[model samples]
Target: MTLTVAAVAIGLMVGSVTPLAFAHLAENTPEERLGRTMGNAELGREVGDAGGPLAVGAIAAATSLPVALTALAAAGLASGVLGRVALRDDGRVRPANPPG
Candidate 1:
């Protein structure tokens, strides 16, 4: 029950945030390259989706499940921090081509 609940919560969070991420990317990317930017972002997401579990499983095989989970969680937190820093602004993503 707990696992199911956690999974649902995670799904909801990801589902909600994904659109926002793409919207932000669209806002920052140039009009000419928006499609390519979106494609690359989706590809990166697919790679992470596949690689994250594989990475955790490899780590667990070498160490332990708890250690692997901890490492994964730590990596997630670090990446979140890095992204926040990289995208820091006045609560808005400025357009790549602002209107005159």
Candidate 2:
């Protein structure tokens, strides 16, 4: 019962952060690449959404549900650390070009 509750809470927390990532992507992307970037983002998201559960299920089958969930939690932590490093920027901002 406690594990189920923790899983649901973690899932909700992770799901809630996706939109913030999308917003960051949208902001950093060049205007010309916006559509392609968004499409790629969507594709990646779809693949993750479909594949994550299947992978977890397979892991659970091979080992146990708790092990599988722990693996996922570790992966999430790794990704969060990597993302923070990759997205870190100094405070400098380039001025936007005046419209022609």
Q: Candidates' TM-scores?
A: 0.73, 0.85
What tens-digit string does per-residue lDDT give for candidate 2 at 1-100? 9679869966975797678889998988778778998999899889878988998899999999988888877877787789889899878784443243
Give one digit per residue, the lDDT tens place, for model 1 in 15-98: 765677889899888798889999998998899789988998999899987677667667766766787798888777566677
Regions of candidate 1 where Cα sits further than 4 Å from its true position: 1-17, 90-95, 98-100
How accurate locally, in lDDT, is each candidate?
Answer: 0.77, 0.82
Candidate 2 — worst ten consecutive residues by lDDT sum? Answer: 91-100
RMSD of each: 3.8, 3.1
Q: What is residue 55's positional error in candidate 1, in angstroms? A: 0.3
Model 2, 42: alpha-carbon shift in Å?
Answer: 1.0
Cα error, candidate 2, residue 90 (Å): 3.0
